[model samples]
Target: MAAKLIEGDPQRLGDYRLAGRLGAGRRGVVYEAYDSGGRRVAVKVPHGDSELWRPLAGEVAAIRAAAPYCTARVIDADCAGARPYVVSEYVAGPSLRGAGRTLAGPDLLHLAAALATALTALHEAGIVHRDLTPDNVLLGPDGPRVVGFGPVSPTETTLTWPRLAMSAPAYTAPEAFTGREYGPAADVFAWGAVVFHAATGREAFEGSSLGTVMHRVLSVDPDLGPIPQPLRALVADALAKDPERRPTARDLLRDLVHADATVRLGAPCLAPDCLTHASPAACLPAACLAPSGGEAPRWAQEWTAERLTAEEVLGRRVCLADALLVARAPLTLDFLLAAGGAMAARLRTPCDDPGLGTVAEDAYVTLDPADRPFAPAMFLRLADGRGGPRGTRGTEERIAEAFGPLVVRAGDLARLADPALPYAWPRLAGWIEADRDARARLARDRLFWLALTTLLTLALVVALATRGGPV
Candidate 1:
């Protein structure tokens, strides 16, 4: 519910007239306003001369590009004005946190799916909702609508002090605490926490102090006893300490929708008479061949045979012998690798190419001689400038035709990788270990202070008794 606007509040901004205050935060106040057409909208007016207005404008622009199914549509914005403001479709309902009851059965499922769908749209548009919490989700009449979409500094302190001094510690990912850049994976972690709270009516991680909450988030596995099956497993995966192990938003949506087995990848036809000249594999989509089967599609089997034959032939070539073939976009390669079912060995390239003596033991060799540092190796180049695969089919179809076995071998690996992590973990481990030690030291210091305070209180009582009442 919106509170009546008070003194000093702007009644009008641009073409909209503010009616009441929706909420207020460090960034600014959100007012319930109406546009020239009298359409109710939520207007966020940043505090005077805030640097955040620029970034907020950028965020609004990015969000405007996203699908509006489960998100509040951005109506308008004016960052260049004396009083910059952003107007969005006003979601008139209580936040998920204010729902006041634990969601169960279909309600819980609906919430999860809706949130995932919203995230998929944002991620597809290359936007990460860094502040996805229960409070940020509005339980609209239509359904759950994810609202706030922008960056929130993890280190920012709140007036709430010991309880929530650090920004949403329970919902924040482990990587965020280690000073690693927050990505879409962090939002997934928050999604897990949010869903867990909705299901159980308690935070996935809870602590009396910020330090304790941070420790739990960084090192402790969340208890999934209260959450029901399937969702429990999904939430657990989302809350994995390692961000790389978490599923993409699209993967989450697919699982929730139970569409993995039925969804088919369609390939575009090169020509009307493509069937006469090229093999059926060149025209038909592989997913259509074995839509519901446990067995790999015929095209996938053929692609596997082709890939093996190519690899064997390439093995004879001295320069290509040890290199892993990319064959598709770097995102496809990452999806296959992270799926953890790919047959190809992981390679690293500290140097430009293996041809140079400075190359690491496991390095990539691309068909394109242009030196690309740490670029994934390509095998059967999907794109050959003519009216063949690249011209006729999409990347997914081409990848399926070329690395079909690898794709079918790792079924879920076909999903495009958005918000992909860099292929390196040596430093990640060190960062986690160091953060753990620092947290441990902080815990010890807190305990020492607690013990010291208790001892001092005891000593004071004893001395006061010995010295009599008034001393």
Candidate 2:
């Protein structure tokens, strides 16, 4: 909602002229502004050195990283001076919280699918929303867009509005309170809570106090009776207390869109690949069905140059459900299936990693193609408890012990394209063994050098005494 700017608001931020106050949160104020081209945009200005939210620099970096997805694009940021600000495309619409009525059927499906898309992009960029409440999702004419993405630096504590509470207890994940490390799974948990709220028009864990709400989030499963059919299972999977048990956003997108068919992949008649025919029946491989009586001559068989280059095929926007139709290998199909599979189907048995419990074992089965390249880095990231130069590390490691093989074969270039193995095994191995703390080894080397130097000096003195020199 727009409101006339009052005295305290800054007149302008960078090239954007602040015309009115769009809204204000604990950490900063969002102002409706006009850019240099007179285009409308929303400029966010953080309070001066305030403890209420993440540092403005952190927020700016996160926004930049998440710009490619359906998120509000970051136009510019001014962190050169004391009062840092970030400007992004202004989405003119009510937040999901103010959308008025509870969503059901197609409406509910679209909401879930859209949020899942946005969350997938954010996770791919290694950015966690941390706060994905109804208020953060803007229901615009274009579609539902996720806003308010920020970075969480190591050593930084939680931040919130001074007037408001510390954090939204009902939306926060269980591990966040238990002192256990969390990553993308935490956002997935919050996504489920938002879905519950959007469908029921009430908090999943409502309580008069923060403690009550947090306890419910940690220990209780939300009452799924209010959520409608089809969606009930999807939402239930997301709301699971075990983060590993929850499906990834990409998984939710495939399920929600396929459940109702309300959302299209991109456009009709625009298949991402030639193999992605109009329907499942059309997509059946020629080898799947054989001639019953006679065989047709090879030349007599119809042939056409309809097949396009793999690059061109992959360039189009295909529906999530149709991805398998065009996939060339079983691993690709396996990746899409596991990516969109149900949470219950994904979880096998519980493992040790706090970020990914049983999901790790499941990863070994289907093989997380995207995660396979980063297993070594993920191992180090979890061990160090910090994100490094390779962007933020997510908890997608299949197994911590798997790093030994990777570290041992770090320099074997011939193993890279050995389709028998994963694509990036050597790099993964190198990153793991290379990132371990070297202080102990350096200390040992220094002690040995000191002892050698001392022995050499004593020998020189003894020789001088034996020779009856100037000493």
Candidate 3:
């Protein structure tokens, strides 16, 4: 419906005039409209249904509630009436569901870090996104922009929502399905699922049908085969059966930042001393730790204060003292989670280790990038363009498409499809889209890409390496 505009439509909502369609969601059909002041924005109007007003208002509220963190900004809203509307600053880049599937290694790592940072901000604000998934996250050129919130539970009113399947089976936290009133950890579970899907281009839970998937998510163990090491433990912990076993968004974010900076990422620091300080973590054999004063951001102070407690998802300790003391501020890794899924194993850009790095988090691997300096630049580029991955494989959609049919129950989706499930493609599409910026970052430095390409030529994952459009 978003692709085709109704002809001769007035295209005017309040002070805004519709120009084109940006996208669609549960509450309304968002159009690329201009507000009264002539600013380009996304104007969301109701789909002739009154039930959407409250949720739309709630989404606006969530955005405002978390705006101080700037996790993602929702400029304004008009949800006061029976049929509500919204006006938000447009995110011109791709969605996580679009790019994440294609981004690998460090590029994905950086992006995930940014997202984790944002998640920290959200948790600190006393708000929890019950619906955290790839489609809801926009991969803007600048960084990750999280969208849609305020509504605690997805309601069933229509079936055309943007990411229906993402909610029912693939992206939602387990508690959401079991009727448990969950908190921030629920979002974290979804976060891991998002990372899982992006890393392998497959679902963490697989089944031949909807019933089978429900059994898989509830009774079966998630297939963590595609997850890399440093991130494996983190992702597994996030998906813990007991919500208490999971890390609070804030804790998860902190651990992610420190862990990412300390080790090469595939390696986890088991030493209590190394794990405690935010300083570059020291694992035996090789050193992946960033400088002592790496993670120092304004947000770092928030996490740095002793008033807040930090704990790993699995009771494994993660501290941030030496690193903070060294920098006298937040470390660089603190900003990583702002990139989304940085703490997860979804990204594998540094491919220096050859064999997908190593097996265990503490297990070490060797990286001999033909051109070491060029690697970081490649990651930054991929981060920028990794909004939507217009990848070469067309058959992959079958996997994504399978979700709508996979876990759907009769009344469950029919009632919640509007506010819950909604439409198809966009949700998963956003996370799976290739983050071109990440690739372009490498591409612009053609020499660097050339060097990395040479190295990738020997990699088994090379089969998974394919170019996407320049979206």
Candidate 4:
């Protein structure tokens, strides 16, 4: 992947000389570099202002924490100058996505387990990867090594803003998008997405639209494609909408390790070198051990906005908006569909409240796209105005017809939906309204303080002049 450094590429990042371009993304440019001692490493230089470089300290700490478990150790970092840079051990391998080779069977299991182990280390240190996708994983000669983990601002939206460039909407956890309390469980959810992609040779819930991707992550089950047996079930559990229900990274590592052990114990090596004893690497073929050693066919691809197709550009925009909008729209027609179907079944038998229908009816208008924020702008472009009725009545009726006759259990209903389904809409509205109010209050407070300070300063000056002191 080495190429001559072109114009705009920094000649030196700290003491390392930028030799060739490793990769470039929205956030930063990665360079294949060598240090003063002639040791090879990767240097990532942020492209924007001081605000973008502020998160580097936290990112560096997280990377250092993850070093013990398949993460490249941070070698150096400098934030003193106008441009900030971080140098980490350069892993010479293709990313899991660009490996250009199929990863399934035992190889896939190994990679998944390694990633889980890495995440376990990271989570134990109280750092969420936030953005863990196939592109971030480097399959080195040893195993899968996670590289990118610095300065991804959850609120940054600009593509030129290097602080938050690694946004993968499909791989993002449901709680993350909803602005709910997300923790290590969110990283586990992304782990499932990565495993799905590796097993199926395709994105788990990829679509032509960001709305489509969001809906799938939030409401629809992932198309696991032809993933076989136990692994499919494991992936499904990881993709569970309820964060608590998803297994811990340690739990995943153990399960994968156990599964791998079971297979090894059951099969005896047929190698003629020795029947006495053998390690997994000693017996397995070199091809099986190095599943990621391959070449990308499109090696000469350049990073440019003009090269991006319309669909690709839109997807990027959606990702950027998703990252920026902390308080998203409260309701979606899809959310109403699932909740309405459950509500209808409950109405059949009398509960404490017979007027539940009225309550549901009252909340319907909020489901309209006009009330929503982040996603509506992007989705509206895809929908024509002449679709149908604007309110939730029409949508509820459609959902009721689809699920009312069937025996739908609450567990089944909540599986594809977020566990905070009941409070999501109301809480979403509350967060958005509260944020607006807080901003207004802060603005007023600033002005009031400014006026008070000015008055106090003038009074002091008058008093000093009357006392014959230097004014």
Candidate 5:
């Protein structure tokens, strides 16, 4: 809803003319504006002067980088002017918070798919919508368009005058309360919460106060009875308190759109080129090779593109090691499943370097338990055949020479396991260790050189004094 311009509001900002007030938040007032070409736009003006415009300026790059899919496109910005503001395409519809109707069936499915697609685009652009509440989602004629991408203010409130406060607290992931930096997984959690609200007309986690709401998010399991099958399972996975356990937005999109039509690949045989062979049994395990006209094992039928938990993969009795061996180049979903399985089993890959085990374990200690599952896939994806400046290198060499330093520089395990990227688990632990040792050795060498130089300089000074002046 747009409100008439009140007294003291600016009539114009740069090329855009302010028409009315769209909304107000801790950041500043958002205005319904029109560009010189008469195109409708939303202008966000910060509360403070130029010093406070940094975040708004940074947001332009982030929004621009994101694919224009289910999101408002950034039109222009004037961060250097007396009154800095950002102008984006004005979405012509009510926010999800203000849409006074419950979503079900096709409507609920559309909302879920759109939101997931928006998140997948954002994550691919290396942007995390730290604040993904109902109010941030505008239901336009095209679809649900996600807006309000910027730094999250601690004092920001969900309450907006006349509009009812929805499930803002419930949308926040558990890790946010524990002081961990928000990641793509957190957005997925919010997606689940938003979808839950759309389907059931209530917040998954509810309480009388902010503290109570946070407590529930951290500990209590939300009642998923209202949500329908497949979706209920997906929502439950998204709402997992452990961030690592949460399905990525990409994973959600794939599941929502292709739940029934997913392609199922039977377990691959031991041969390296089994996938390329003519016979279906070429890729199938010896036991899985059905007798004349007989159906394959129930376990082989279960291997679909659908997202499965580590426990589910193991329960199917599939061999993760065999899966990894036969996985085609440029890793596929099958590889990701095997990686997750490897993480759950704590399967140690054979490494000649005896110290590698200790190093990997040390690096693993730095990660939260939730982050451990993706390390192995992360390692394989990063180290697979790719190598040094001159040529390709071995796995151990790539780990020490290339992958290790990258992990140390990132300083966050979450980045390695990002849902949009390929998955990994244990190998990253080892890489982190190797990287640290290399850095430590370099530091020691520098220190020794400095000590030697200091001693030589002192001896020269003593020799000069003993020679008593001159020649």
Candidate 6:
């Protein structure tokens, strides 16, 4: 069999059954796997007997270690094996290089903003992604994630650095050619070059070959034609002839994200590229499929240029089904699913809900085993309280008090039916802004509930099997 075919084959790696291949390059191939826990995980098995797999130990470690720094989160890693592999959050989307010429105006601006945020996070971690080209940056549902780290620098550099790492003609800073220990500053320079390409469909650095591009990058001024005012200054700063003159990634991102108190803490609202997916755990990263009020392509066009943004497809809809169905992460729907029959004797108004607006107990519904909370239960008590003879019924208020912490407060309830709830949600997020820690506590409580439900289900099966009476 051809080497590519052999490496790319979908098969078992240990006990995990591989579904299919995702992507592969010099490092190794990644396959979809179902773990013992039955969670959908992307498993990367390293190439055996290759020098590339050696340094990959550090690469894998650094990736998991710096998970918070970028959108490409590492869920697990096995570098101790002869062939090191890393399992991470599978963010599905196109690389910036492949994003095509379709993006312009706001879509383009949002992409820049996401890139700036990711770059800022990476720099803060003190790890410089030596290869910051468009091909290495992916547009995930939540935001941009930097990838392709063959030339990633460690806390200290040694011999394995490639010639390409020495300097890219377009993105190479002045000091890079002269051999200075590159740092976050190098990445800043690359961002300018990458953004230039993103803004206008042109490689900022055009040269006859590798040699020409390098010479010109060192000598020429960057072409900033028709660059909008918002990012023009940032691009110029990154492309500064003097490395010291450039601003840090965070500083640059702050300016680009329009860092108001509201915009910074909440999810960024720039471009579709900033949106990885409506459900961060399931599906690949992207704007919604059809985008709000947009058209979807016929099945045939998927082969060509009809890839819809997640927002375009979902049209501002957020579905928790995929992530909830699988034990993906914190967002599982098992608890929400249990809410249908969840009978909270006291309903533990336990510190989880943030939407309380002097409402009673019935207003907030308990979460199901899948951890999904229903809006109807969250607001029913509001109506009950208003119609009652007093502020709230005595029993309802007490139930509300017990579950007060757990109940989704009425003030927190907005029209769950709102089309824009996923895309343009209110400033007071359902997750944040609560006086109590309902979201977290509910997640914890729901695990117990799901276990109980599973036990109940198994017990019922056992009773049926052992029954003496014939039907």
Give Cα-based local distance difference scores for all models. Answer: 0.59, 0.59, 0.50, 0.57, 0.62, 0.50
Q: Which residue segments of model 5 deviate by more than 4 Å?
A: 55-59, 151-167, 260-471
RMSD of 1: 30.2
Residue 130, candidate 5: alpha-carbon lDDT: 66
TM-score against truth, every candidate: 0.53, 0.57, 0.55, 0.52, 0.53, 0.48
lDDT of 6 at 48: 49
Regions of model 6 farther than 4 Å from truth? 1-62, 65-70, 149-156, 159-162, 165-174, 259-471
Candidate 1 whole-model C-alpha lDDT, 0 to 1 = 0.59
Q: For model 3, state the Cα shift of residue 353 in Å.
A: 36
Cα RMSDs of all predictions? 30.2, 22.6, 23.7, 26.3, 23.4, 24.9
How close to the true structure is residue 182 of candidate 6, measured as C-alpha lDDT? 71
lDDT by residue for model 3 (1-471), tens: 123346644456676656556566553466665554445566666555555455555545765666333245557776666546666776555566665455556555555565566666677666776556677777665556666554332443222222444444666566656666567787788777767766776778777876677667667778776667667777888877677788766665666555555554344444534443444222332443434667644434443454232322112223233232223223333333332332332322222211111111111112233333232332222234322112322322222222232222332111111111111223222322444455666677998878788887656354555443232
User: What are the per-model numbers of colliding residue pairs?
Assistant: 5, 4, 80, 1, 13, 62
Mark the regions of model 4 whose C-alpha exceeds 4 Å error after superposition.
Answer: 51-59, 151-166, 267-471
- Across residues 1-471, which tens digit of lDDT does each residue of candidate 6 receive? 011224536455554545456566434566555444444456666544544455555655555555253346667765555445566655556677776753455455556655555565555555676657787776654455666542232323432333543434566665676676677787788888888987787777788786677766777886786677657877889888678999887666555433221132233333322223343322422342445455643331341243443223323222212212122223112222121111111111122212112122233334232322323233333323332212334434444344443333353232222111111122213323342377578888999999999999998888877895432
Tell me the RMSD of model 3 versus the true structure.
23.7
TM-score for predicted model 3 compared with the true structure: 0.55
The window of 10 residues in a row where model 1 has the poorest summed lDDT is 340-349
Candidate with maximal lDDT: 5
- By lDDT rank, best first, the candidates go 5, 1, 2, 4, 3, 6
Worst 10 residues of 3 by lDDT: 353-362
lDDT of 5 by residue, 36-58 (tens): 45456788886655655654566
Task: Work out how many backbone clashes candidate 4 has.
Answer: 1
Write down the lDDT that model 4 would get: 0.57
Candidates 3 and 6: which is better by lDDT? 3
